[model samples]
Target: MQKNGFPLDELDFAILSCLQKDGRMSFTVIAEKLNVSIGTIRTRVNKLIEEGTINIIGRVNPAKVGFGAYAQIAIYVRPATLKDKVAQKIARLPEVSFLAMTSGDYDLEVDVMCRDNDHLVQFINEISKIEGVYQTKTTLYFKVYKYAQPDLNLLK
Candidate 1:
């Protein structure tokens, strides 16, 4: 498979599959499972990291961690030119979990997590204060049924 012009083989996919299951999975374990040498697994993982193909990070469930309010906010930025600048400002917010510029009625979309309803209200007030923000529509997620990474096996 080609990723950002870098060629990746079956071994690479296998290694990624193992890592997806458990980010902290050891090179020794992956090597044994894939029937390859430990050095090979280590080298491949390093290469993947350097190429910006993947990052192993601890995933957290917001609800379990006391973040009870989850929301998606659609922002309308006037003059359009300030969209990038506005996005940069929003991205710095710790409560913001995801932010993207899209083509539609709104210029930007943001997903945020907060401790509760009051915290969410405060967050909205904070974002609304940003310069160039004309308006915003916030949608609260009552429940998230599924949240997961893409299945690497599909690449096969």
Candidate 2:
């Protein structure tokens, strides 16, 4: 892992990988798997959390949780200087699962999950009302085959 420029060492990667698989996995189990002391695991985990390198949280399936409408929206922002301001407004929307500024025809891209098509429509209307929003193209996702976190092994 030292070969890479990333600050994380092999042990850190190993610990993150284990937690990625199961956030609730015990430090003792990780210690046993990685052949490290429980205290070492605890200390490393605490450091990781403090540094904001990792977040331990329960992930739920949006569909299973009553979010039936999933969609991606590409937004065109006028007066590009207000891009950051617009992004801040969109980010505050509870229905938005992901949002990013992009270099393309669209100034911003956002993913949202809603309870139904009506809810999606309402959400879109809400976004359109924000300042600097010129136009938006939304695509509905009927079925999502894969939704997950990045694979840590790839960083190795």
Candidate 3:
């Protein structure tokens, strides 16, 4: 089935669903479970990766890694034309994990991770000094619950 200009067959969707459940699952195991040849599974998996349809990676807990402070910041750029440029510069900051150019009161939204409240303050100060940055509003995240992958069944 092709969705959003991506050509993905049933087998491709199955392979992706399986990997989403357990990214570490071996090709042999997946093949056995799916009742297909191991080589076929391997080829499909590689094709999926090459096509940028899926990515298998390990994710870490930010708090466990000493980044206890988390916040989302909304930035208003001085000129609308500078939004992308400013967002690109902010994306390069080490403290910024996620950045998006938005259309609303704020020109951009950023997710930042820091060691503590002091670190967050320092990071905010650094952002304030960037050119084209007009104003910013930040909301601290006390707890985060993330779902790595949503249920594939919903795609149906």
lDDT of 2 by residue, 63-131 (tens): 998999999999999999989999999999999999999998999999999999999999999989999
Which stretches of candidate 3 lie above 4 Å from their native place?
A: none
Highest TM-score among the candidates is held by which one?
A: 2
Minimal lDDT window, size 10, model 2: 1-10
Clash count for each candidate, listed in order shown: 0, 0, 0
Ranking by TM-score: 2, 1, 3
| Residue-by-residue lDDT tens digits, candidate 1, 39-89 | 999999999999988998999999999999999999999879999999999
Model 1 residue 15 CA deviation in Å: 1.2
Q: What lDDT is reached at residue 151 by model 1?
A: 96
The better candidate by lDDT, 1 or 3, is 1
**Candidate 3, residues 1-156: lDDT per residue as tens digits?**
787688888788888889988899999999999999999999999988887888888877898889989999999999788887888889899998889988889999999999999999999999988899999999999999873677777877
| Clashing residue pairs, backbone N/CA/C < 3 A, model 1 | none
TM-score of each: 0.94, 0.95, 0.90
Worst 10 residues of 3 by lDDT: 146-155
lDDT of 2 at 14: 94
What's the CA RMSD of model 2 in angstroms? 1.9
